[model samples]
Target: MATGSPRPAVLRERVAGLMAGTLTLPLGGCRAALLDPQGPVGAAEKTILLNALAIMLAIVVPTILATLGFAWWFRASNTRARYRPQWVYSGRVELVTWSIPILVILFLGGLTWVGSHDLDPARPLKSTQPAVTVEVVSLDWKWLFIYPDQGVASVNQLVVPAGAPLRLKLTSASVMNTFFVPQLGSMIYTMNGMSGQLYLQADKPGVYAGQSSHFSGDGFSGMQFDVRAVPATDFKTWIDRTKAAGPALDEQAYGALSKQSTDVAPYTYRAVSPGLYEDIVQQHLPPAPGPVAAQPASQVAPVKKAS
Candidate 1:
């Protein structure tokens, strides 16, 4: 009876399986959605990654171990090792060494290219479920989030429903800014006279860190916000209560509000004047612009009717 060796096969399997299993257990498990792709916008991209890594490791782990083993076992001192430095490489090795990486690269690249388009922020929420549209204005060193439908606005805090996609339309009131909510999605830039879009959904209800990924003026360090993902019903109630307890934000008030500041607390404006966000987007909707345009309050208009 011939006794066949199983060490090579067993070693390969054990190493590869260990590598894959440990990675998945720690980084790609079900709970991963909390800090990564389980959320709304990152789902598509994350799925591609999780799927691809699982496939790549099939070859990657084995290939790595083989490289190390080949180097060590085939040392010049080993009499059993074959010496063929001048010998030409075999076609089989050539084909495999080049082909494997090519395939991996193609698959990973394809996944990324396709995901970029599929998860575009502007893409409509195809599902019958409607997403809440949150209008965000990046201030010099702060954030102002307005819920148009809810008819309320908040400084430094954004509230939305967890597990539901959120459509964000962002622009800057003064200098360029960036809106970033880690553990939810990518950071999107905001520019004066320009607008951008970002989509995000949190899988679980939590208060996550939101900040400006760009540097602007003196208060750049303070340009941050809070992202709160909660249940839909609770979100609605939050909006209602915020509106009930806050004061209205009119054009004049907004003009004053857009100035640079930092270390802000959450505050709500009960009634936002219609088109307040649009006005901020336009930049010309302010009370006055240049020094020439600015006149004393007494000179602009009389308190009484000008009949």
Candidate 2:
């Protein structure tokens, strides 16, 4: 007898195994960044998350067990199970059910309220050393980091010193986007014609991944960068090396960079035009062209007035 296609049950089992493998593939070698933090802000946020989960599970787990118990005890075969035909709502049960959720709500609310102000993105982190200010600009599908004090700039790469606070002034050159580094905590928005402030710190030296969280356009998927946190001495060495090479980021160079492109390689600018950041914020250097401006207003025909 010729064996045809495999049985349905076996085929389903094979398909399920393939699907599970596919789902776990992306998570290979990946640690849960939110739960395993590298900085003070991220650790604090993780604590809140775990606390919230435990609080909810306190009520959820018991409710699930109670449901299973009731189903098994009241089953048709359990002749000893009492049936109360006239049973109305019990005050004790109502009190227990309602009080638990109310308590959970109160606890969660208080936690959020305190954490928000404590970890405000604009609030500076306390450190013995001075904070490093890096002006961040979100381009179409890239990030431009300017170290004004150091007189140097870089594209798609952010380098800072470990154990030192970071003061970030973020703005967008094109559409609005969000700047986020999961392991470092705090996500802030970057908008064109407006600037926002954020403070962060890395307690140790490591490379953290960063990206634009908000959807911008076709190239949004590739708008990723790496944050290199190094020792103070290494940070100074990097700045010197950057200053010794690469072309100056002048207006012409910036204009060219503002144009839409994706997956830009990290590069440094030996020198940057003074006040370039301020110019972009103040719109002195015109905002980058966006989707709205892709089609000129003059090209569209005007609507006629009703007769």
Candidate 3:
């Protein structure tokens, strides 16, 4: 009787099953969202993180091993090891101490400088495909995502086509907040009367987690959202369904939606009013002068009305 090795397919399946089991372990087994990203931007960020860690560990590992080695070699029972009590300033020791740290610092500084420009939130993504524009307003404890091209909007949920670049225009309707999607990288700030830009893309169909990384108020813990990426065909189908079944997002509706709240359920709208985002930004601005603007409080003369 001849004994044969396991087939390639069976071997692959067994390995995959083992990986799945390990990933689902109870304690901290949930994957690190930043390290295991679903998009290009997130992957780049993860690379930066790993490179920095490796550079530091280059120094750390040897130092730890040398410490253990010294401890064991100079053990009380060991008689052959030489004593270093009289040694104080060796050239080799000085060189190793200064040069290695200096080199690490220089490398880290250069790496940070280059990475800063590459990961700039305002810089547009480099891609051949057309980008989709989404206007985001950070309201009290909730996120509002507006799809300009589709003329639709959603609260606490964002949906886009996988493999297409996303161009985001972000602002705040109330307090300042941060719009962050861990799997897409980049955390951009949103403030009243100011707009920020961010570029991101999902490489495949999946639902990624998004949240307000910055603390806002009591409801900060509930400031979470979902990013759903689907195929282009499915994205279009979603748009059509939203148009047919969802309600319109107009000024009055937005006013109600902007009120302070917590744990707001995700919902979509079929239609969004044009320039609504711009209007929200304008509302935060100081009133502009009229044809006959009021004089400054100090410059104005006191008015004597009939008593």
Candidate 4:
């Protein structure tokens, strides 16, 4: 006789083990950034995410179980299984399937609507302390953060006072990009020739990871920055230290800085040229040559206008 297949129990055990490993493989590499948020905004977002997941799982888990239950109950070897050849859909089944989905939609819609308005990036955070204004410019492979209030600027790093709100005014020096600090929540876009506002605050002193979430070019993988949230005194000291040294960020300096480069080290500018940020937004300062290679005059495609 030919060799028989493995016993059904052994096959089931191997399949179960494989399924377990498959389900857990991705989790091993996952970071709980959203779940372990460090700011109030991030916390609120976490709540929304968990709530949505719970709502979805209410139906999902039951449906999965019902599927398995049906499969087993209707299996060929089950002697007591119902075999109604002309059975139609039952009213109870229709009611359950329709009602659950409708309820899920309403819950999800209401949650999203409330969260969107409440967490509007433009809306200022409520704080007794004044908000710090930081001008952000996304370049080809780096981030430029200008602290207009402090009269200082930094490349590839952002420093803010913990417990105080931050009002971020963002734009891009080249193609459009997104500015995101995962622990602080709210990933807003930085567009060329346009400004966007975002408000975030760190609940405690810590270093958070920030990056350009929108891919722009080859150096996109290395486009990351650090957000340092320090105490108020420390923040003031940093400003003073930064001001006492480093070169001023005049138009000429900015011009050189705008050139495409990757993995740039963090550096500070003691002073920023007056109206530089405004000029960039108003197109007085020409936008950077983006990542795209220069094409020959005859080969360049003509720009099109939408109707």
After TM-score superposition, the amount by which residue 66's alpha carbon in candidate 3 deviates from its true location, in angstroms, is 1.0
The positional error of residue 123 in candidate 4, measured at the CA in angstroms, is 1.1
List runs of model 1 lying over 4 Å from the truth.
1-38, 55-60, 286-307
- Model 4 worst lDDT run, 10 consecutive residues: 28-37
lDDT of 3 by residue, 132-240 (tens): 8999998877899999889999999999999999999999887788999999999889988888899999999999999998887777889999999999999999999
Return the TM-score for each candidate structure.
0.74, 0.85, 0.81, 0.86
Task: Tell me which residue pairs clash in candidate 2.
Answer: none
Candidate 4 versus the native: TM-score?
0.86
Error (Å) of candidate 1 at residue 95 is 1.7
The residue-by-residue lDDT of candidate 4 on 1-307, one tens digit each, is 7899999999999999999999999897456677668888999998999999999999999999999999999999999997999998899989999999999999999999999999999999999999999999999789999998889999999999999999999999899999999888999999999999999999999999998888898889989999999999999999999999999999999999999999999999999998899998998999998998666668768799998
In candidate 2, stretches whose alpha carbon ends up further than 4 angstroms from where it belongs are 1-30, 292-307
Give lDDT for model 3: 0.87
> Which stretches in model 4 have alpha-carbon errors above 4 Å?
1-31, 294-307
lDDT of 1 by residue, 12-48 (tens): 9999999898887766555543346447666666666
> How does candidate 1 fare on TM-score?
0.74
Which candidate order results from sorting by TM-score in descending order?
4, 2, 3, 1
* Candidates' RMSD to native: 15.4, 5.3, 13.5, 7.9
How many clashes would you count in candidate 3?
0
Per-residue lDDT of candidate 2, residues 1-307 (tens digit):
9979999999999999999999999987457788778999999998999899998998999999999999999999999999999999999999998999999999999999999999999999988999999999999889999999999999999999999999999999889999999999999999998989999999999999998889998889999999999999999999999999999999999999999898899999999999999999999998988644355458768899999
**By summed lDDT, which 10 consecutive residues of candidate 1 come out lowest?**
287-296
